[model samples]
Target: MIDLHTHVVPPRTPFLERLAGSDPRWARLEPAGETGDVIVAGSNFRTVRRVAWDLVERRERLAADGVTGHLLSAMPELFAPWAPAGDALDYARAFNGWLAAEVTGHDGFFTGLGVVPVQDPVAAAALLGEIAGQGLLGVEIPSAPPGAPLHDPVWADFLGEAERLGLLLFVHAVGGALAATFPHPGAANGVVFPSSIGQAVGGLIAAGTLERFPRLRLLASHGGGSLLTSLPRLDFMRATTPALQELMPQPPAVYAQRLWFDPLLFDATLLMALVDVVGADRVVLGTDYPFMGADPVTHLDDPAVPAALAAAIRVTNPQRLLTSLTAPT
Candidate 1:
């Protein structure tokens, strides 16, 4: 079985220091046995387990948990949306290279998804080819850049390029202005991140992104962050607002089904709600691995889900998602 929403990080390198120069925004980790504190710009960003970089520990966890493969996204703290294009692109290239090699070294135990500097759409567009060249399936973007909506016109070229490449987009909530508004970790992570992802996913549907780029594929983290409860209001607004309807002629939920989601909701009821909206065909098993344990429901055999549905989420869906190591043809 495959876990689609796992993460890994590259240890700091001197080149990254050279890229940053005097900038204090780059990420650094302080190891603590099986755990570590991720510090960015001199402040503690988040505490993470060693699975963030240790493939050995990860392999053990995967074996113990019965997962066969993992999709390795650069840990969310490594997504530096606020950095300047030159620094950001360079940093992203370095990180992407390390991540791709890590996946290769794991002997088929992991698949890779890299990151791009989204603040500059043009540069981010250029990086997609390099990321594709490294044999990663796709890229992981923050729900949005610091202050801009992802579906804004500035990202059109980038989105078009990604569609042409058939790259999968893993939309995790990490960037938004709310991080500055809520300085405390609990406020920033618990509520703001979820809110950010929900807004970005909804914004993409309402913006007719699918209409413009039909082959674009997306997988959202945290069960797409309250998307379970948000679509009705979105459809209500679309029906009532002529401007929205002009942009998107279909109900928001109809477009939502075309995208993918991870069942990281931590509750069977919530997972079922997401499955009902997007369908089990669109739902994949996601552990948030090494961060939220290997399996949300413990194991597929536990009966939280039916045996048939569990096999589909654990195996069938992930195979379809990773059918092409290159982009989808």
Candidate 2:
């Protein structure tokens, strides 16, 4: 079955030295041991696992895990929203080059979803065209850039270009400011991060992004991030808030059904509920592979889910999304 939500990093390159280019603000990764600390703007942003760069081992393990094909994006921590525009674009091109080369080597076994320097929409759109021309699936973007909302005018411009190019967009949380506001300190337990994805998705729906960009296909990671459970509250709010209704012409849950989601919820009932909310056709297999949350490999075979629905989630749905590999007619 096609796994829609896996990540890969290139074999270690001189990311820092290449982008530093006399700029002190460019982010760098300082290797400590098995993992490395990411330094951005003079502060430790986060730590990354070494397995993220072990491409060959990861490909082999995916086969063993029953994933016939998977999508690869730069590790989210490397998005480097803090970098200056020139450095950020340089990093995007460099990373996309590595990804295209890897996909060319592996061909059908792996497809690429490259990254763009989202802080600059003009550069991002230009680079996105290059990525689509390379036959990669599309682009992976952070839920939002550092301090901006996903539906801001700049993002709208970039997304407009994405839709014109018929590219798919995958939204994964990168633990920005929103992650820090979670009721708990540290937010490292993985709870706050996925919850932030839910909030991001809600924001997108409220902003009428799908309505504005009808052809823009999106895949929301982490079971669409609490979306399945939050629908009742969202709809209730819509009913009470006339202004929100004006912004969201339809119910929030309806907008959710049009987007795709990865089944990484780690529970059978939640998987079933995800299907119930967004339909099996919108749910795809995702392992978050080679990371702490990779276990259980739950293939949506829960007795709670219908056999037909499970098959769709595992196989039928991904085929539709994969069609983006072809130039859109």
Clashes of each: 0, 0
| After superposition, candidate 1 runs with Cα above 4 Å error | 13-15, 180-184, 293-304, 324-328
Q: Candidate 2 lDDT, tens digit per residue, 217-311?
A: 88898887666777888889989999988888889888888889888787888887777777768887776754544464454666777788777
Q: All candidates' TM-scores?
A: 0.90, 0.85
C-alpha lDDT of candidate 2 relative to the true structure: 0.75
lDDT of 1 by residue, 179-283 (tens): 778767666777876777888898888788767777788889877886768899988998899998978888888888988888766677677777788888888
- Ten consecutive residues with minimal summed lDDT in candidate 1? 293-302
RMSD of each: 2.5, 3.3
lDDT, candidates in the order shown: 0.80, 0.75
Compared with the true structure, the alpha-carbon lDDT of candidate 1 equals 0.80
